[model samples]
Target: MKAKELMDKEFVYLNCDDNVVEVSKVMEEIRRFTCPVVNDNKQLVGWITSFDITKGLREGNEKIKEIMSSYEEITTIHEDAPARLAVVLTANNKFVTVPVINDDNQVIGMIRSCDIVELLSELYDIKVYKLYEAMQHQLKGVTWEELMSASALVSKKTTGVKISPEDYEANIMNATFGEAIWATGGLEKFFAGLISVGEMVIARKVGKARR
Candidate 1:
């Protein structure tokens, strides 16, 4: 598949000068951490996220441009580019999605992580699910964020147990991190183990869907 094929044209974006507070509402409404930033001409100018909002809020920055990852700071893929490039871009830069552009460099659509995940599942005939969905029975009404936050505290003091996103996803239910989660005293934690705070961030990333 190519970027144009994978990209979603019907997606939410933010204006470069939009209020910082607006991005928070956008993120909340879209249930996504990131959004493409565009100029008045609708050309891709940058990107913004909850992380930027937190930083901007701390510094009292009111404009999206103040904290957005500018064009020079992000990697955009051509509409016809191979989809795997999006995977590489996200892997190297921690982007949740890649903006797809036309020959004019106008923002046309986006290749989201969830799109990639769905494609992979289809191509491989593998069963994949959001961790939160998979753990519905285990949660017992406790939110994933709460249980994850409680479990995430384990890495702060533990000496040397690092779990990368790839490792955690591939072995989340079986990872030794479960032990640490249990250590954190979460009554509804997954696998009854502990994990890294970093992976908790990754867990959230994996939880979102395109729709």
Candidate 2:
């Protein structure tokens, strides 16, 4: 897959002259953590993240340029770059989102960690809901069997709870490989123990389809 295939085109951005107030408004409205900053020449100059904006407000009247991360220091990838490269950069930088630039250095789009994870999930044919619940345990170093046991407890506690297929798909698509396995195991055991005996059978079918 290419970066262009997964990049978000309708992203919010900021101009160098834009004030903290304006930036704050945009971030709030869009619920985004960062925005690309451009110069009057329509060239990419820097990026303003929520953290930078908040710091600027604290300092009172600090220009966007003052708090923004310089374009030179920010890592960028061309649209044609392999999707694996994007995953590597995201993992290495711990970035929630990264900007995409064209040959002219013009900002074309942005890619989020969530998007990459989701793409991988779909390619792997994993269930999103199980993946998410399992990841929480995996992060805590919980074993597969232990994680399954815990999931059963939670399901029993909330019998009336319902998860939409879209939400489930999103979770599976967005989770990493290790995380997906952990989540699948957890959810499979939970459903089997609490809901039905056919849970694992259904999961296996989905897994095969994803491949």
Candidate 3:
């Protein structure tokens, strides 16, 4: 599947002149952590996120250019590219969404992490709600963020090489439980337990579907 097929054309974004306050409101309204930034010509110029807004406020930055990640720093994918690339890009950058650009590098659509996950669930015939329930059960006390952080240690234990703390936090949020376990080489008990539960849930759902 290509990005154009999966990307949402009707999306919210910020212009280079928009301010931190506007960024905050857009994020809240869209319930998104990140947004693409555009120029007056409607070209993809950069990106802004809640993280950027928080830093901008601390620095007293009033303009979008002051707080937004510049085009050079933000990554964009061609609309014709494979949709799975969106998942890789988000995982690598810890981004919630990636802008899809045309040949002229103009913003055309946005591919979100949820989009890829939902597609994956459909392709595999896996029940997403059941998988989420299993994750919630296994991660009762630990925030997904914290469990992600611990995954770095799990990786080290399995591979005998330490993963950067930064990489773990950045990549893990974009990963499903199965992806997380794959990253850790399936050595972590927490992830293994989550997988076991998720498999059982999926099995039950498959049985129900057949019935």
CA lDDT scores, all candidates in order: 0.69, 0.70, 0.72
- For model 1, what is the alpha-carbon lDDT of residue 30? 78
Task: In model 2, state the lDDT of residue 86.
Answer: 88
- Best first by TM-score, ranked: 2, 3, 1
Measured with C-alpha atoms, the lDDT of residue 168 in candidate 3 is 60
Evaluated at residue 202, the lDDT of candidate 1 is 46
RMSD vs true structure, all candidates: 17.2, 12.6, 14.8
Choose 2 or 3, whichever is better by TM-score: 2
Q: Would you list the clashing residue pairs of candidate 2? A: 117-174, 118-173, 118-174, 128-171, 128-172
lDDT of 3 by residue, 81-159 (tens): 9987888888888777889999988899988888877886664443333454456566544344444445466557656
TM-score of 2: 0.59
Question: lDDT score, residue 83, model 2?
Answer: 73
Clashing pairs in 1: 177-193, 177-194, 178-192, 178-193, 178-194, 179-193, 180-194, 181-193, 181-194
Error of 3 at 120 (Å): 0.2
Q: What does the lDDT read for residue 161 in candidate 1? A: 67
Sorted by lDDT (best first), the order is 3, 2, 1
lDDT value, candidate 3, whole model:
0.72
The TM-score measured for candidate 3 stands at 0.57
Instruction: Quantify how close model 1 is to the true structure by its C-alpha RMSD in Å.
Output: 17.2
Over the stretch 1-211, how does candidate 2's per-residue lDDT look in tens digits? 7888889998876887788887888899998998888766556889888899888888886478878888887888888888788899999989988888888778889999998889876745654445545554434433444434444444444455554444444544565555544654764554444333124334544566699
